[model samples]
Target: MKGFIEDTNYSIGLLDDTATPRDVIDNYIYEHTLMGKNAFFVADLGKIVKKHFKWKNIMGRVNPFYTVRCNSSPAVLEILAALSMGFACANKNEMSLVYDLGIPMENAVYTNPCKQASQIKHAAKIGVNLMTCDSETELKKIARNHFNAKLLLHIATEGISGEEDMNMTFGTTLKNCRHLLECAKELSVEVVGVKFHVSSSNNPQTYIHALSDARCVFDMAEELGFKMNILDIGGISENEAQLEELYQAVSPLLDVYFPEGSGTRIIAEPGSFYVSSAFTLAVNVMAKNVIEHDQHLPSAGKQISNKPAFIYCMNEGVYGSFARKLSEKLNTAPEVHKKYKDDEPLFASSLLGPSYDELDVIVEHCLLPELEVGDWVVFENMGCGSLNEQSPFADFEKPSLYNFMSFSDWYEIQDTGNTSESLMKSLCVPCFHLGEDQFCTV
Candidate 1:
C-alpha cells in the first residue's frame, strides 16, 4: 500500500547513481524481518539497460531476439520491448506475451524446433511466420499448419572438446540439411535461412566451424532455388567481453562468406546474456535442525564440538526461485544476512525447500554461520530463469519482485532516443518510499 497503486503489477524503486542493488535488498530484508519473513527478489534494471547498450555497441551487426524461456518477468519483457529488441518465443504462451505487448508481428520468431500443431496455427493467425525447424516432421507440420511460414534450417554445430553432448541435441546434421531443404521444397515451404547454436564454451574455432556449416547450408538452399537471407548464429556468449572476442573472431569469416549487399540479415538468440547478472534473490530460513557428528578417538569416542551439521528448510526452493537447482545447473552459494565476525564458527549446511519432496534440495553442501528460524539468505546472479517459478504446494507462493534503477541509468535509457518518459510510465509505477519521482500508470 505504501508503494504503487494496487493495479500496478510491479513498481520501480529509483535509486541515486551511487546506490547499488545491495541497498535495495537490505531495505527489503529489514522490513520483511519485522513484518513477515517472506522470500522476494530485487532486480537492478539498470544492469539490464546497460547490457542492452553493450550488446548494441559490441555486436551491432547481429540483431538479438530475446529468448522468452530464460526469464519472462513482465517488467523485463516491457523494458526490452521498449528498447525495440526482437523476441524469440519458445511456445504459444511466450508468443502470446510478445503479441500482447503490441510489438509488430514481424519482430517475433517462433524458435521452438519441436512445436505443437496448435501453436503453429496460433503463429499463423498472428502473422508471425518466421520460425526455425530441424526435422522433416516439424517442417511438414509447419507446412500443413502454417502455409505462409518462412523457415530457418537449424544446423548442428561441431562441439568443442567437452561440449559434444550440448551440440548433438536439437539441430539437423549437415548431410541432412540438403534432404530437409528438398522436403521443404516439395512441401512448398519457404526455407529462407539457417540457424545454429554453439554451446557456451566461448571458443572462436567452434563459431568458425558453425559459420562454415551455415555457409554450406546456404549453398545447398541456393542449389534448390531458395534465396536465403537470414542467418541466425543461435545463442551468444555470457558477457559482452566474450561477445566482443567472438565478433572479432567471426567478423572476417562473415565478410568472406556473406559480405555486405548480400541481403543476408544476421541475428542471435540471447537469453542469459541479458538477464543473468541483473537480479538477486533473497530467501528466509523457515526451519533449522542441527545434527551432531561423531568422531572416534584413539582412547574414547568423541564428538566434533567445533562444527555441527545443519539442515535448513528455506521458504523458496527448486519448485520456486531455485528451480535450476533441480538439474544441478546453478551451484550458487548463499550469503548469511546477519553481521557476524570473521572468526565466528562455521558449520556444514544443506538447504531444502518447504515441500516434503526429497528432490526439493536447493543447496546440497555449504558452509555458513549459525542461523535461526527467521534469518535471511541472499543469492546473487539469479536473473536467468529464476523469477518465474511458483510453488506447487499450498504452503508457499511466488516470490515478489522489487525492481529498481539508478537515475543515471534512467537518463541513459532516455538518451537512447527510443525509450521515452511515456514508455517508462507504461512499463512500471514508482515507489514513493525510494524517490520523489511519481510514475502514474497510463
Candidate 2:
C-alpha cells in the first residue's frame, strides 16, 4: 500500500493496521521529552476525510465552504481542496493560498463583510467575483474596486436569549438590506444572495425567523430585478444529532422558500466541524508552583483542612495555541501524559502560559495529579482556532505539526477516485517517520 503528502518537506506516516493515533502520540511525546520537549500537534488527516463523508451523508444539500481563518495549515487546505470542497477566504493571504492550490476561482467566495480596498482589488485581479457586502460603504467600495463583482448581501440575525450576542453585530438589518440592494442596483453590481450567521446555541425558532427574513429580502430583491440564487448559512453544528435536528428545522423552510425546482444554492461555513477533532496538541510543563491554602468548612464546626493548590505553567498558552480562549470559552481539559494510579490523590491545579502576563492563564481551575517540570500534557479537539495564532509577544514558537493517516484511510481515498496525482503522488513506507527534524519510533 502507498500513501502520500503534498509537501515533500513533510511526509505522511502511513500507519500499519494495528497502529493507532495514540501510539503515534506516545512515540512523539517520548521522543520530544527526551530531546527538547517542545510542544507539538499530531494530526490525523484521515479523520478529515471521514468528516467530509459524514457531511455529505447528513447535510448533502448544503455545500461546505471550508472557512480558512479557522485553521490555515497547508496540509489541511490541500486535503480539503483535494476533496473538491469550496473555500471561504477572509483575506488576501487565504485567497492566495487557495488559488495556489489550483482550486477553481468559482469555488472560492470572499466572505469578509468588511474588506480592505486593496484586497478587494486583489480578488478582482485574481478573477474572484463573488464577495460579501453588508453596507453601502462596502458595496460602493467594491463597485469602485471591482467593476464585475457579484455580491452576497449579509443580513444580521437576532441572538437567542441567554446566548452570546455576537450575532447582533455584522450584517445589515432587513430594512437596511433594501437600501443596500438599491445602492447595488445603482452601482451596476449584481446582488446574488443573502448571508447570515447563526451559532449552535441558537434556538430552532431562530432559523425559522432568519429564513423568513431571507425570503423577505429575496422578494424585495426580485421586485428590484436582482437575481438571488445563493443562501450562505454562516456556521455549522459540531454535533451530528444537533446537525440533524437543525436540518429538520431548516430543510422544510428551504422547501417552502426555495423549492426543489429553485436554482438557489445553499452553502455553509464549516471550519471547526471538519478539523477540530482531527488534531491533538501536546504541551510540556515548563514550571510548577504549589501554594498551601487552608479550606475552611463551616459545616465541620469551623474546621480547616490544609492542602496544596498547584499552579502549573506550560510551554504554550493563550498567547499561542489557546489564543481563541481570549474571546471564546474552552471546556476541553488536558489529560496528564504521565501515568498515575486511579486512586492517586488529585490537587486543585491551574494551568498558565509561559508568559508572565496575568491574562495568559489557560485553565483557571482543574483537578490534576501532581506533576513536575518537563512532564507532558495532551489536549484533544484542538484543531480549530489554534494553529493560526499571530502572537505579538516575543519568543513564541508555534507547535510543530506531525501529519499521518492509517493505511486503510489512504486506500479509502484511493478507492473514491476523488484526488489527483499532484495531491498525493509519492509514498512513504514507514508508519512513524514524518521528516528529518521529527521522526517517531513505535
Candidate 3:
C-alpha cells in the first residue's frame, strides 16, 4: 500500500520536473491540445469496451448487454452492437440509440419499469422483444401499445440508490406477481422471465441478493403457471468480487427451474462494469485559485479558516464522469491511482475536481500528497469513469470527433482517427507549456 499511496508532499511536480499523476500529465496534453483553453471531457467510450468484453468469457452463459442509460455515445453504441451484444434501454431516446446501433430487435430489452405511451410505442415500432413493468398500469400500457411485448416485472434491490429503486417504483409482490403473470397469460404476452438489479451500489451480496431476487421471481413465475424461459439480471458480472457468489446461488436454479423445453436464457446487462476504467478523461487546467474566508473570534483573539483553500478548476466538473460526486454509493469509496515525485512524503488534506464548491470536494481530511494546478486525476477501480450522465456540455458544440486543438499549431499530429486509444496517446503527450516546449518535457 505504501507503494500505492501518494501521501501529501506539497511541491506539485510540473512537466519536465517530476512525475505527477498519470491523469495530471493527461490533463496537460489535453489542455495543450485545446490550445490551453481548458477542455472539458466527453467520455472515452472505447476504452472500457475493449478491455472488459472478452468474447469467450462473455459468450458461454448469461449474455451481456450494454445499459443505454450509461454513456451512450454514437461511436460507443456502434462498437457495442458490432460486438453482437444486446442493449437495455430505459426510454425512447435510449431505445432509438440502440436501434441506431443496429442491434437485433430481439437483442434489445426495455428495462425501465415506468414509461410514457410514446416510449412503449417506439419500442413496439422497433419490435422490442422484451420489456419490464412493475405496476398494473405499466402492464396495461404495454398491452395497449406493444401487444407483442413480453415484460419482466422489476423488483427492488432494496436500499439501492436514486434511479435504481425498482422496488420503490416497480415490481409486484408474490400476490401481485401472480396477478401480473395472469395478466400476461390473458393477453398472450409472454411473462417468460423476470429481472432485478443487483444492488450494484452495495458490496458483497448486492449481486448475490439480486441473484436471489431473480430466483424468487422465477419461482413466482413458475407458480403462476407461466412457463418462462429467460432471466434478466440487470447489471454486470464483474468489478465487484461477488460474481462467484451470484453464479453459485443462481446456477443450480438453471436446471431446477428451466427444464429443456422450459426455454429460459440468462441475460446480464452492464453499464459501468463494461466501460469504466477503459479510459482516462482528458481535461485541462481551466483556472486555479485558493479561496479565503477567516473566522475571527474577537474577544478570544483566535482566527481559523474552516474550509481548506487548496482548490482546482478543471474543464470537467460534476457533470462528466465524476457526476457520481453526489451519489453515496459512488462517493462512499473513491479510488485514486497515484503517481508520486519523491519517495519520502508528508500527508496533507487532499481534494480534487474542477470546482471550488463545498460539496464538489473529492477527498477531505485524507492523508494524501498535495497536488496543484495542471495536475491530472483518475480513479482506481473505476466502476463509472468520468463521463457522468449530468456532466455539462460545451457552451458551444463538441470538438469534431477527435479534432481537439493543441496549444501550439506547430506540433504535428498524425491522424489516428477518433479512437479512445489514440485520444489517450494524444492526452499522454506533454504539449502544453506557457514556456517553450524545448524547455519542458514530461
Q: What TM-score would each prediction reach against the true structure?
A: 0.89, 0.90, 0.68
Q: How close is candidate 2 to the true structure, as a TM-score?
A: 0.90
Candidate 1 stretches with Cα past 4 Å from truth are 1-8, 160-166, 293-305, 420-423, 426-442
Q: What order do you get sorting by TM-score, best first?
A: 2, 1, 3
* 310-426: candidate 2 lDDT, tens digit per residue: 889899989888998899888478899989999997777789988868999888777788999999999999999987764555675667788888888788777766665555743
Error of 3 at 284 (Å): 3.5
**Each candidate: RMSD:** 4.4, 4.2, 10.3
Q: Residues 1-442, candidate 3, lDDT per residue (tens digit)?
A: 0010011111111233232234343544544554644433323333444544353253347777778776565445554564567888888888876775555789988887778898889888988868888777888888888878877777656553435444554555544666777777777677877776655443434545555666777787778676667777677645444455555556565556544455678787877766554334444344455544242112133333454343445555555445666674443332222467666342333354454566665544333344556554444433353432443454522211221223221112122232233223334433324444322345
lDDT of 1 by residue, 1-442 (tens): 1322112355566775444566678787877777687788878888888899889888868899999888887668877887788999999989988887778988888999899999999999988999999999999899999999999999888866655454668899998999999999899999999998887776899899889989999999999999999999988876678899999999999998878679999999999889988888899999998886333121133334666678899999888788888774673678988899999877777889998479988877767888999899999889887776878877676677777787787777677666634356743544323332232232
The weakest ten consecutive residues by lDDT in model 2 span 295-304
Clash pairs of candidate 2? Answer: none
Q: Which stretches of candidate 3 lie over 4 Å from their true place?
A: 1-34, 40-60, 156-169, 201-227, 237-240, 259-262, 287-309, 329-340, 343-355, 365-372, 378-442
Residue 252 shift from truth in candidate 2, angstroms: 0.8
Best by TM-score: 2
